[model samples]
Target: MFIDTHCHLNHERLRDDLQGCLERALAADVRKMIVVGYDGPSSEEALRLSLAHPGILYAAIGIHPHDATTWNDAIAARFRELARMDAVVAIGEIGLDFYRDLSPREQQYRAFEEQLRLAKELDLPVIIHCREAYEETLSVLAAHPLPGVMHCWGGTPEQAQRAASLGLALGFGGTLTFPSAQNVRDSAMCIAPEHLLLETDAPYLAPAPYRGRRNEPAFTRIVAEKLAGLRCLDLDQVASITTQNAYRLFPKLALPP
Candidate 1:
């Protein structure tokens, strides 16, 4: 079975047709998913979905770099309470985004540090989101050194090795299938199987043939196919490797089955 380690079923695009998305995911052999949150409401929604679906869906909650400005003591307190829930598997969709600079650099740093501390305190793995801020992201991760996946990895092979050395798994998504994303493919090839993960970042970044259309968890199969080809491994081999990697990084996922 394939596990879409990062997706957003809480987003309106996918939530509106939730049943259809879940069915297609199952049909595609994508048996599980991690519904990621970027902010307060979305994190709550992610938790709700995981609660509703039990073994099939799990949640990773935190403030994204774009929403870092909203971080504060009360929000941290709320995340602490929510993290205690059985369905909230990790603390994430959290990290830096220099590309957009949606939140001030200082605020982003503070939020990232605070959330990393939160994850450590709760003993949960993380799911990081990085864009044009790999150095800063990697630097923080090196300092914090929590177990997690670098969701939708877009770093160099060297950086991929750096993150893996820090005990973080690198998650590959639809970008692995893009013709021009040779660097991403290269990173996928270079990483060890134990440090590899698969994700879709659904309702966005759909893999080829289905590119430009709304993405969903079912398309993780396409991402897996691309990775398997790049690494010269069978599709099922990639699936088993990544699924075990996901379960290893997010121990809560292993609890269900």
Candidate 2:
């Protein structure tokens, strides 16, 4: 069985046929999925999905940096309330996204810090989304005490090393399947199996064969294949290890029988 450590089932692409998408994923041996939320509404939707899906799906609630501009105490309070839900496994797809600059850098930092504190307070793991702000993200993480995974890891070997040092598992996705994404692939190769997890970031970063198309949890098998190739291991071995790693990070997930 495989685990899609990060995905957005609450997004519009998957919302229409959520059951079908999950069926296809299960057919492909993708047993468990962590549906991520980026903002208030999405986070609530993620929690609702988790409730509907029960053991098959779980949730991670947080506000994305893009919505940082509108973030306030009320939103944080809502997240804290959601975090108390049994199905809420982590506090995330949260972090810095300097590439988009949708929200001011200061606002992003403020939101990130607040969420980090929330995770720490809730004693829940985090699923961070960082883009083009590795150093700044790392700096903030360094100043905070939290447990989490770096979702869709797009960092250099040095940064991966630092994140691993802080007990943060490095999440690999379809980006590693790209031939030109040497940095991401190298980072994947550098991470130890125990400190690594697999994700698709669906319907976003689809793997090679499905490149340019909408991604799905089923495509996570391709990600496992890539990681196995990069690590010189078998597909089943990679799947087994990554699945175990994900369970380690999010103990709320019920493992496949």
Best candidate, TM-score: 1
- Model 2, residue 8: displacement in angstroms? 0.8
TM-score (C-alpha) between model 1 and the true structure: 0.98
Which segments of model 2 are wrong by more than 4 Å? 255-257
- Residue-level error in angstroms, candidate 2, position 55: 0.5
Error of model 2, residue 28, in angstroms: 0.9
Clashes of 2: 0
Model 2 Cα lDDT, one tens digit per residue, 1-257: 99998999999998998888998999999988999999889989999998998888899998899988777999888887887778999998889998999999999999899889888888899999999999999889989967789999989998999999888899999999788889998898886678889899999989998899999999889899889988999999998898888888897785332
Candidate 2 CA-lDDT value? 0.89
User: What TM-score would each prediction reach against the true structure?
Assistant: 0.98, 0.97
Report lDDT (Cα) of residue 108, candidate 2.
Answer: 94
Stretches of candidate 1 off by over 4 Å are none
Candidate 1, residues 124-166: lDDT per residue as tens digits? Answer: 9988989999998999998898998899999999999999899
TM-score between candidate 2 and the true structure: 0.97
Cα error, candidate 1, residue 194 (Å): 0.5
C-alpha lDDT of residue 186 in model 2: 87
